[model samples]
Target: MRLERVKEILLQQVEKGKLFHAYILEGKNCDHLAGVFANAITPYPEDIVYVEPDGLSVKDKAVMELQNRLSMKPLEGSKTVAIIKEADTLTVWAQNRLLKTLEEPLGDSVIILLSKNIENLLSTIVSRCIVFTVDEETEITDLEKEAKLQARDIGEMLLRKEKFFTITKKLAPVLSDRDRAYAFLDALQEWYHKLIMVSMGIYEDDSLESHLLTKERLFSAIDHIEEARRELNRNFNVSYSIKNMLLKLL
Candidate 1:
C-alpha cells in the first residue's frame, strides 16, 4: 500500500478504537511507509514508538524497551504504534523471540513489520497480522504477464554460462525510476538467493530465472550482486549503484 493509504487506514483505525494485533508492510518503498507511520502518529503523543533494528541482538531487550514506551499511560491518545523496519533482517534468534510479543502484544498497541519478503517470515509471525502489499497498481493484463514470464525466461537463459552483465543491460530500461532504484534491488537479491539454492543442489525448478543458469556461475554472480546491494545501502551514489549493478549482472 502507498504511504497515503496506510495513513488513511491508521487514522480510520484510531478513530474506530480498534488496534491491530500486528501489521506487515511489504514493499520496495518501506522507508516511505515508516515515515508515513511516524507522521501519522506525530500529532498524537503516546500513539507511536519507532524502533531501529541496528546492532541490537537481544529481542527481549528490544521488546522490553518498546513495551516500556507503550506502558507509559497514554498522554493524549487511545492507542500506541510501533514500527519495526527491515524486520526480515532480524536474526533467527531475534525473530523467534519476537514471536512471543506478536503472540500477545500489549493492549492498545499496534506493531508494524516492515519487510520485503514475507515468505521468509515464520508462519506464526505471519498468521497474527494483517498483510499489506504496496504495489497494487492497475491490474495486469494476460499479455503483460506473459511478456514478463518471457522476460524472466530470457533473463534466466542469460544467467547461465556466467552471463549476468548482458541481461542487466538489456532489461534495466524496462524498469521505472523507483523500480530501477529500489524494487529492482530487492528482485536482484531474491534472484541471487535462488542462485545459491541452485549451487547447493537444493533447487530443481528452473522456471525462476536464476535457476535456468548453472550453479557455479550463479554463485559467482550473486557475490557481485550482493556487493552492489551493500554499496547502495552505504549511501553510495544511487546512479552509480545502479550502473554498477547493471555492469555486474549484464
Candidate 2:
C-alpha cells in the first residue's frame, strides 16, 4: 500500500479508538515509517518497547524478555507498544513464543512487526496482524527528484529522435553520482510505466510524449530502463549502461 494510504488508515483508526493489536509493516525501506507509527500509536517513550535482533535471528531469550515486559501494565500510557525491528529475523523458536502472545495479546497492547522481507515470517504470525507495505516513492529525496526530471528530459529527447551523442552528453552529470544514476533509471522506469498505462487507456495524463509513443515502443523503453537498473545494481559502468539504455530506448 502507498504510505499516504497507510497514514490515512492509521489516523482514522486512531481517531476512532480502534487501533489493531498487531500490525506488520513490510517494505524495502519501512524502518522509518515503523518508528513514526510506533510514536504515533504510543506517544510516551516509556510505553514503547523496541526489540532489535542481536544476531542473525531474534533469539528466544529476547522474545522471552519481551513477553515478560508485555505481561506488565503500561508504565504511563493507555497502551504498551512493542516494535520488533527486522521481525523477519525472528528464529523459529522465537516466532513460536511470539505467536502465543499474538494469539492472546494483552489489552491495549500493540505489537508492530517491521520487516523488509515478509516471506521469512510465519504465515500464521502474518495472519494475526494488519499488513501495510510502504511505498518507496514516498521517501524520494531532492536529489532523486532532480535525477528523475533529468531522466524524463532524456526520454523526451529520445522520443524527439535527437542524436545519441547529445543524449549521452545530457546524462554525463548523472554518471558521476552512482545514487543519481540509479535514481535516473528508477525515474525512467516510472516514466515508461506511466506511458504504458496511458497507452492502455488506464491512466490519463497531458504529456504529449506518452501520446506520441506507440505501445510497443513504450514497452521497449520500460524493458531497457529495467535492464539499466539491473546493470547498475550489478555495479556496471554507469556511463556505458546509460548510453546502452538510451541507444535501445531511442
- Assess candidate 1 and give its TM-score to the true structure: 0.48
Per-residue lDDT for 55-168 in model 1, tens only?
A: 743254676677677667656675677788777776677677777877767776678888887755665575556556566456755544544453455446545534655554
Best by TM-score: 2
What's the CA error at residue 157 for candidate 2, in Å?
47
Could you tell me how far off, in angstroms, the CA of residue 194 lies in candidate 1 after the best superposition? 30
- For model 1, what is the alpha-carbon lDDT of residue 203? 37
| 41-154 per-residue lDDT for model 2 (tens digits) | 778999999899996878889999999999999899888889998999999999999999988988879898999866577756765666665667667679777976896798
User: What TM-score number comes out for model 2?
Assistant: 0.55
The lDDT of each candidate is 0.60, 0.77
List the candidates' TM-scores in order: 0.48, 0.55
